[model samples]
Target chain A: MNERILELFEETPETYVSGAEISRRLGVSRTAIWKHIEELRAEGYTFEAASRKGYRLISKPAKWQVSKLLNGMKTKALGQKVHIYDEVDSTQTIAHKLVASGAPEGTIVLAERQTAGRGRMGRSWHSPSGKGIWLSLILTPRIPVYFMPQLTLLSAVALCRAIQKVCQVDIGIKWPNDLLIHGKKVSGILLESSGEDERLKYVIAGVGISVNLLEEDYPEELRSIATSLAIESGGKVSREELVQAFLLEFEEMYALYMEKGFAPIRLLWEALSVTLKRPIRTSTPSGFIEGIADSLDDTGALTVITPNGERVKIYSGDIELK
Target chain B: MNERILELFEETPETYVSGAEISRRLGVSRTAIWKHIEELRAEGYTFEAASRKGYRLISKPAKWQVSKLLNGMKTKALGQKVHIYDEVDSTQTIAHKLVASGAPEGTIVLAERQTAGRGRMGRSWHSPSGKGIWLSLILTPRIPVYFMPQLTLLSAVALCRAIQKVCQVDIGIKWPNDLLIHGKKVSGILLESSGEDERLKYVIAGVGISVNLLEEDYPEELRSIATSLAIESGGKVSREELVQAFLLEFEEMYALYMEKGFAPIRLLWEALSVTLKRPIRTSTPSGFIEGIADSLDDTGALTVITPNGERVKIYSGDIELK
Candidate 1:
C-alpha cells in the first residue's frame, strides 16, 4: 500500500495527491492513507500538507531504498542482490559473514554509514552518514589465490571509470589501492579473500568512496590530504546513481577479466595510475627500496628498477613518489 | 592418577608389580587399585592377573595415549598441545574447528581412524583403524598467501626425513605432496589455509601415513599402488615414535623456514623428490600437458618443459611418469 501511494505521488510529482484520491486509487480508506503518510513521515519522508491541497512529497530520505535503487539498474550480476543497511560497523564484516553462509558471487552489502570503517593496513576509513558510497562486493572467481591482486587493481579501474562517468570529475589511481583527485585521496579499495589450498573460495572487495561529503566530514588530520567529489566538483553528487554506475562498470570489467585474463585490466590500471614511471621509494614487508617504478608483472606485482640496475618485484608495499 | 600408574608400570616393564605394593606406594586402597585396573582394561589395555604374582603389564592398547606420547617428547612447539581421538571423520575437520575457536599454532589433532578421509582433488584416502598415522598439524605462518605451496613442500620434506629416521627405510617425495617408497605410495600430504588480504591466518597440514598396514589392509584397487611402512620394512613400526619424530622434524623445519626462507627447504625437498628431471605427463587445471619435469621454482611450483620447448609452471596437478 505504501508503494502504491508512493507510485501515485510519483505520477504527479509536482502536485499534491489528495487523501481521498489515494484511497480510491489503492482501494483503501482515507484513515489508512493518513496512517501510511504518518509512517512515511517517520521514515524521513517529508510531506507538505494543506487544508484542501492534500499531501505532497517534499523530499525522500537520504537512507538507501532498495526499490528505488533497483528501479533502473543496468548490471547483469553485480548488485542484483543487495543488502542495504542504515548503519554498519563495516560492509566487509557483513560480507564475510554472508560468504560463510554461502552468499553467491556478486552479492553486495551497502551501508549509509559505517561506525568502524576500515582502510588498508588497518587504518580507519571516514564514512559519514548518507554522504558516500560504502559497499562490499563478494566475488568467487575461478582463479588461483595468487591472482587476487589483479582483482584489486581491476576494482580500482572500475571505480575510477564509474566516478568519472557519474560525477564528471577526473580520478587517478595511486598504485595498489587509493584513488586520488588533484593529488588528494577520494577513495580506497581493500580486497580480502578466503580460500583453501591454492583455490580462492571468495573475495570481498570493500570500497569506500567519498562521493557527496562536505569539507567538514573528514577529521582534521585528513582535511589536508582527503577530498570528496562534491568538494572537488563544486556540487553534490547522487550516491545512488554513483553506486549503480560503479556496479555496472565493475560487472563489465569483471567479466572481461574472467574471459581474457588480466592483460586488459592491467593496461587500464597502468593508464589510470599516477604512481608508475616515477622515481619512488617503497616500504615493502622485507625493507625499504628506492627505485623507479617500472611496470606490473604477470602476477600483478609492481616491478621496480633500483639504482643498482636490478629489477625487483614488490608484492605488498607502501610507495611514496620522489 | 592414571599417568602415575603408567609410570609405575614403565618402571618394571618386564616384571610384575604387586597390587599391594602399588597400593602402599600410591597410598591408595587395594580396592581402588583394582578399580583402576578394571578401568584401564576397559580402555583396551591388557593385564595378566595371577593370585600370587600380582599383575603383569601384558601390552598397552593400540589407541593413542596422550600422556605416553607427550612423555619425553623432543619438540618445542609442534605437538605441545594434542587432541587425540579413537575415531573421527578426519583430523583436518577437527583442526578447522579448533582454528575457528582460536587454537594456537602448532596445535595437533590425531585420530586412530578416519572414516571419511580426504585427499587432494577430493579423493578419498584409506585410513584404517589403529594401523596408520592420521593427523593434522595447525600452523600460523607469518608469510604471504602465495608462499603457501612452500609449506606443503616443507611438510613433505619433514615427513620424509622423519619417516626415514624412524623406520630406517628410503622414502622419497613425489613432486608436491606424495611420499613414496620403492615407487609405491606410502603417505600423502594435504595443505589447507584460511586468510584475508595477503596475510595468512592459519594453515592445516593434513598428513596421512600408512605406518603398519598389511597387504590385506588395502583395498584391491589400491593394493598394487599403496604400500605401508610395515609392508616395506617387514616389521611393525611404532606409531608413537613415528608421530614424535615427525612433530620434532616438522617443528625444526618450520623454524628454519621462518628464520631463513624457502631456499633451504626447497633444497631438502629436491633431494628427496623423485619427480624432477624425468619425462612426465601432467594433468593440470587447464588441461593435460606432456613435458619433462624440470626444477621447482621459488614459489614451490613444479616447472615442466613442454614439447614445444616452453617452460610452464604447473601449480596444481596430477603427474604420470613417462
Candidate 2:
C-alpha cells in the first residue's frame, strides 16, 4: 500500500495526486494515503500540501526505498531483492541479519546514512547522510574459503567499471582493492564472511563510494586523503544510475569470476591499477616494508621489491606512497 | 561463584566434602550449597550421597564447568579462558559470539555435545554427549587472512601429536586437516573467519574428536567411515586429558608457526601425513583430477602431480587414495 502510494507520486513526478484519486485507485482511505505520506516524509521524502489540492510530490526518495529501486531494474539477478533503510549503523550490519535469514545471493542493502560505517582494518569510513553510495551486497559464493579474500579484488574491478560507465570518470585502483581518483581515495570496500570450512554461509561486501560529499564534509584528517566524484567534477551526480550500473557490472564480473576463475579479472584489474611499479611503504605486522610496488600475486597480494632486491608478498597493510 | 562451587568437588575428586565444610569455605548457607549442587546436577553431574558422610565427589563432566579446564593449563595464551556448556547447538556458534564480544585470542569454547555439530563443507559431524571432545578455539592471529587456513593443518599436526601421546596410537594426517587412524577418520577440523580485506578479525577453529564414544554410539553409516578412540583402543579414554594435551601442542605449534613461517609446521605435518606420495583421485569444482600426491604448498594446499605432469593445487577436496 505504501509502495502503491509512492508509485502514484513517482509516476507523475513534481505533480499533485489527489487523495480521492489515490484512494480510488489503491482502494484505501484518504486518511490511509495521508498516513503513507507521513511515513515517506519520515524516510526523507518531501511533499507540498494544499487544502484543496491533495498533495504534490515535490521529490521521491526511491534511492532509499527498495520498491522503487527494483521497480524497473533490468538486471537478471542483481538487485532483484533490495533492502532499504533511511538510516542504519551500517548496511553490512543489516546485510548480515538478512543473509542469516536466508536472503538469496545478489541481495543488496542500501542505507541513506551509516552512523558507524567501516573501512578496511577497523578504520572509520566517512558516510554522510543522503550522500554517497553506502551499500552492502550480500553474496553466497560457492568457493573455497582460502580464495574468499580474492573477492575484494574482483569487486574493485567491477566497481571501477561501474563508476566509469555511470559517472564517465576514469579511476586508478590500488593493489588489493581501494579505488583512487587522481591519487586520492574515492571508494573503499570491506568484505566480511560467515562460513564453516570451504563453504561460505554468506559473504557481505560493504562498499562506500564518496559520491557527492564536499571537501569540508570530511574530517580534518581525511581532507587530504579522501575525495568525492561531485567535488572533482564540479557537478551534481545521479546516484541511482550509478547504482544500477554497479549492479550490472558486478553481476557480470561475478559471473565471469565463477565461470573462468580470477585470471581474466586479474588482467582487467592490473590494467586499471596505479599502485604497480610505484615507490611504496607498507606497515606490516612484523615491521615497516619500504619498496617499489611491483605486482599482484595470484592470490591478490601486493608483491613489493625492496632496494636490496628482496621481494615481499604483503597480504594486508597500511600503504603510503606518492 | 559457580566456579567456586565446582572447585570443592574437583579439589578432592572421588572424596567426600562435607556440606557444612563447603558452606563455611564459601560463606554460603547450607541451602545455597544444596541449590548449587542441584544446579550442577541438572547439568549432567552425578553425585553420590550418604546419610552420615557428606556428598562424595564421584565423577566430573567437564562440559558443565569451565574452571576445571583452565585450572592448571600451562599454555601462555591458549586455553587460558574456557567457556564450557553442557549442550550447545554448536561451539562455533557461541565462539563467534564471544569473538565478536572481544574475546581474547586462545579463548576456547568446549561443549559436551552439539545438536548440530558442523564438519568440513557443511557436513554433519556426529557429536554424542559426554563421549567426544567438541571444542572450538578462537585465535586472533596477526598474519594475513590468506595464510590463515594453514592453521587448520597446523592444528591437525598438533592434535596428532597430542593423540599419539594420549592414546599411544599411530595416526595418519590427511593432506589438509583430517586425522585418520587405521584408514578411518577419528577427528575433523573446521576453520571459520570473520574479516575484511587482508586482515582477519578472528579465526574460529572447531575441532571434534570421537574420543570415548562406543561402537554402538555411532550410526550404522558412520561406523565404517568414522571410529572413536575407545572403539579403536578397546578402552574408555579421557577427553579432558586429550584437550589439555592438544591445547599445549597447539600453543607450541602456533608459536612456532608465527615465529618461523609455515615451514616448520609443514615439515612436521608431512612426517605424519599418509596422503602424500600416493595415487589419489579428487573431485574439484573444475572437474576430477587423478594424480600422485606430490607435496604441500606453502599455504598448506596439497600439490598434486597429475598424470599429465601438471601440478594442481588442491585447496580442499574429498580424496580417495591408494
Candidate 3:
C-alpha cells in the first residue's frame, strides 16, 4: 500500500491529487492514504500538502532502504534478506549474532555507518556515513574450514567485478584480501568464522568498500595505501547498485565454487590476481622466505620456487609482492 | 618470601615456630611473614592463631592459584602467567578478546567452570565447577593460519601425555581434536585464530578436560559417549596437579613447535592416534571419502589411501574409524 502511494505520488510529482481520487485509484480509504503519507513524511520525506488537494511527495532521503536495495538485488540466495541499519558498530558483529540465532544463509547486513568497523587484523575501518558500503554476508558453506582462504579470494573477485560493472574501473585483488586500483587499496575483506571441528557453522565476510571517501577522510597512514572508487573513477558511485551487483556476483561465484570446487574460482582468482608470476616474499614470525611465485595448489596453498630451486609450500602468512 | 613460608610450613607440618625465628632463618621481617600468612589465608587456607605461636597451617584448598600453580608449572612460556577464574562464559571468548588486546604469548586462562563452554563444533562442553579443567592457551605461533590444524594435534598429544602420566590410561586423538579414553571422549579442543590475511596474530586453543564427573552427573545422551578421569579411575584426581601437568606438557610441545616444525610432533601424534593404520572415513562438507588411514603429513593433514589406491589429503574434518 505504501509502495502504491509512492508510485501514485511519483506519477504526478508536480501536482497534488485529491484523497478521493487516490483512494479510488489504489483501492484504499482516504484515511489509509493519509496514514501512508504521514508515515512517509515521518521517514524524512518532503510532501507538499493542501487541505483538500491531498499530498504530493516532493522528495525522499537519499539513503539505502531495504525495499529499494532488495528491489534491485537479483541474486538467488545472496541478498535474499537485506537488513539495513542507520548506524552500527560493526556489520560483522551483527551478522555473527544473527547466525548464532539461526539466521538464514545469505542474509546480508548493510549499515549506513559503522562506529567500530574492523579490517583484516583488528584494525579500525574508517566508515563515514553515506560514503561507503559496509556490508557483511552470512555464508554457511559446505566446505572444509581449511578452504576458507579461498572464500576471501572469491569475495575479492566479486567486489572487483561489481566495481567494474558500476564504475567501469579496473580493480585487482591484492593477494590475501585487498582490492586495489592503481596500486591503492579501495576495499578490504575480513572473513570471520564460528564453527566446531567437523562442521563450519557460518562465516561472516565483512566488506568495507570506500565508494566516495575524499583524500582527507582517510588517516594519514592510509593516505598512501588506501583509495576509494570515487577517487579511482573520478566520480561517485551508487552504493546501492554496487552492493546489489556484488551480491549477485558473489552468489554466482559461490555457486560455482560449490558445484565445481575451487578449480573454477581459483582460475578466476588467478586471472584477477596481481601477485601471480611475480617475485614475492612471505614473512612469518619465524623468519622470511624470499621466492618466486609459482602457482596455487589444489588445496589453495601457494607453491613458491625458492632461490635454491626448492619448492616451498606457503600455506598462509603475510605476502609482500616485490 | 611466600615461597619460603610455604617451604617452612611444608617442612614443619604440626609445629608453629616463632616469627622472629622464621624471619632470622629466611632473612626477612616478621611483618613479611605476617603478610605472607595473610596472602596464604586469602588463597583459601586455614591458619592457626596467636602472635607467639606464629601461623600454623591447618588445611589448604585445591584452588588453582597463579602463584601456587606457576610454582610447579615447568613450562618455559606457556604458563608463566596463569589467570584463574571460578566461572567464565567461555575461555575462548575471553582469550580472543585478550588476543585482540595484545595479551602476551603464553598467557593461560583457566576456569573451574564455563557457563557457555564450547567443544569442537560449538557444542556445549559439560564443564561443571570444581569438576573439570577448562583452559585456553594464548599462543603466537610463526606458522600460517592454515597450519593451525597442527596445534590441535599437538595439544591432543600433550594432553594425552599428561593424562597417561597420571592415570596410566591410553587416550587417542579422534581425527581433528577429540581426546578419547577407552573409545569414549574425555577431552575436546577448540582452536580459534585472529589476524590479517596470511599473517596470524594469535591462536587460542581452548581445551576442556572432564577430570572428575561421576557417571550419574552426565546427561543420558552423553553417558555412552563421554568419560571422565574420576569415572575411569574410580577416584577423584587432583585438578590443580592435572592443570600444572598440562601446562608443563603444553609448554614443552609449544617450545618444540616454535623451534622445530610439525615433523617431530607428527611422530608423537602417530604414536597416540587411534585412527592410524585402520579403516577410516572422513566426512567433509564437500564429500565423504573412505580410505585406509596412512599417516599425517608434515603440514598436519591426514593422508588416507582410498580403495582405488590413491592417497587423499584430509586437512581438518571429522574422521570415523571403522
Candidate 4:
C-alpha cells in the first residue's frame, strides 16, 4: 500500500492529491490514508499538507527509495530481484551468501553505505553513507572460467556508458578495473567467481561507483586519487537514476556479449580505455614489467611489448601509467 | 587413548599386548582399558583374546580407520586435518562448507558413502558404503584460475602413480578426468574452485576411486563400464594404504606444480594418458567434433586434429574413442 502511494506520488511529482481522492481510489478509509502518510513520513519522506490542497510530496530521503528505483527500470534480468541495505560490511559479502543459497542470475545486492567495501586485489573502497552506489550483481554466465576476465571488462564498459548517459561525464576505463575521470578514480569493479574446472557456477561482480560523494567524503590519502560523479559534474547526481541506467546498460551489454562474444565488448572497452597506447608499469605476480600498453588478446589479457621487443601477456596486475 | 591403543596394536600385528601392559603404558586402569576395548568392538573391530595374550587385532571395520590413516601420514599438509563421515551427501559439498568457514589448505573430508555423489558436468557418481575411497581435498594454490584444469590433470597423474604403487595395476588417464584400467574407468576426478577474476581462492578436488568394490558392488548399469582395483588385481585392495599413497603422491605432485609450473605435470599426465593419438568424438558445448587427439597445449587444453585438418583446442568436453 505504501509503495502504491509512493508510485502515485512519483507519477506526478509536482501535484497534490486530495486525501478523499486517495481513500476513494485505494478503497481505504481517510484515517487509514493518514496513517500510511505518517508511516511514510517516519521513513524520511516529506510532504506538505494544506487545508485546501490536501497533501503534496515535497522530497524523498537521501537514502535509497526502492519504489523510485523500480519505477522506471527497463532491464529484463538485471536488478529484477533487488536486496537493499542501509549499511553493510560489504555488498559483495552479502551477494556471496545469497549466491551460495541459490540466488538466481542478475539478483542484486545494494547498500546505502558499506563499512568494509573492497576493490580488486582486496583493496579498500571508500563508500560513505548514502553518497555512492555500492552494489554486487550475481551473474551465472555459461562461458568458460577462462573468459571471466572479459566480464570485468564488460562491466567497465557498461558502467562507463551508464555514467556517460546519467552524469554526462566523459569517463575512461583504466585497464582491468578502475573507471576514471581526468585520471582520478570514479569507480572500481571486483569480479569473483565460484565454479567447476571449466564452467562457472556464479560470479559476484561488485561495483562501487561514487555518485553523490563530495571531496571530503574520501580519506586524506585518497582525496587526490579518488573522485565522484557529483564532484566531476559540479552537481548532485541522482543515485536512483544512475542505478537504473546502469542496470539497463549492463543488461543490454551482457546480452550482447552472451550472444556475440568478447569481440564487441573488447571494442567498447578499448574505446573507453585510458591505459592503451601509453607507457605503463605493472606489478604482477611474476614481478614488475615496464612496457607500452598495447592491446587486449582474445581471452581479455593485456598484451604489453617490453623494451627488449618481447610481448608479454599480463593476466592480472596493479598497473600505473608512466 | 583409543588411538594410542590402536597404534600399540599396529606396532606388532603378529604379537599381542596384555591388559596389564596397556594399563601401564596408557596410565589407565584395566577397567578403563576394557571399557575402551568394548567401545572399539562396538565400532566393528574384531579382537582375539588368549589366556596369557590379552588382545590381538583380528580385523578392522571396512569403514575408514582415522587412527590408522593418521598413524603413518607422511605428508606435511595434505590430510593433516581430517574430517571423516560414515555417510554424506557428498564430500565436495562438505568441503565447500569447510572452505567457506575458513578451513585451511590441504584439509580433507572423507566419507565411507555418498548418498548423492556428483561427477563432472553434474553427472552422478556411484559411491557405495565402505567400497570406495570418496574424499575431497581442499587446496589453496597461488595460481591463476586458468591453470586450475592443470590441477585436475595433476590429480589424475597422482592417482595413477598411487594406484600403480599400491595395487600394481596398470592405470591410464582418459583425457580430462577419468582413470581407466583396461579400458574401464576405475576412478574419476572432479575439480571445483572458488576465486577472484585472476587468482584462485581455493579449490576442492574431489576424488572417487573404486578400491575394494567387487563386481556386485556396482549398479547394474555401471557394472560393464566400471572396474575396481580389487577386481583388476584379483584380490582385496587395502583402502587405507591406497588413500595414504594417494595423499603422499598428490602432496608431492602439488608441491612440484607450485614450484615448477605445469610443464612437468603435463609430461607425467601425457605419459599416462590413454586418449592421445586416438580417433575420438567429443561432445563439447559448441557441438560434436570428431578428431584425433594430438597433444596438450601449454595451458593443459586438449588439442585435437579434426577430420577437416583443423586443430581445435578442447577446454572441456566428454570424449570417447571412436
Question: What tens digits encode model 1's per-residue C-alpha lDDT throughout A82-112?
Answer: 9999888999999999998988998999998
> On lDDT, who's better, 3 or 4?
4
DockQ of 4: 0.44
State TM-scores per candidate: 0.75, 0.80, 0.74, 0.79
* Stretches of candidate 3 exceeding 4 Å from the true structure: A1-62, A214-225, A280-282, A286-292, A303-322, B1-68, B87-103, B114-116, B194-196, B199-201, B214-224, B231-236, B286-289, B308-310
Tens digits of per-residue lDDT for model 4, A203-276: 99999998876654555689889888988999989888999998899999999998889999999999999999
The true-structure Cα RMSD of candidate 1 reads 10.7
Candidate 2 lDDT over residue span A29-121, tens digit each: 888888988876555455777887788866434355345557657689878888877789999999988987888998898888788998887
Worst 10 residues of 4 chain A by lDDT: A39-48
| Docking outcome class, model 3 | incorrect
Candidate 2, residue B6: CA error in Å?
A: 24
Residue B250, model 4: Cα distance from true site in angstroms: 2.2
Task: Name model 2 segments beyond 4 Å from true.
Answer: A1-68, A198-200, B1-68
TM-score of chain A of each: 0.80, 0.78, 0.78, 0.80
Better of 1 and 4 by lDDT: 4
Residue-by-residue lDDT tens digits, candidate 3, B1-322: 7767888888889788778878989998877878887766544455675667876776654456566676777777787877788778999888877877888999989886677998665568887666678899988876655666777789888888998888877778777668898899999888776534444557788889988666645667999989999888878787777877887888888888878888899999999989888999777656799999999887688899999999998876678878
DockQ of each: 0.30, 0.41, 0.19, 0.44
Put down candidate 3 lDDT per residue, A58-119, tens digits, no spaces: 55644775677878878988889878898899998898789878899999998877889998
**Per-prediction fnat:** 0.33, 0.62, 0.27, 0.55
- TM-score for candidate 2, residues paired by index: 0.80
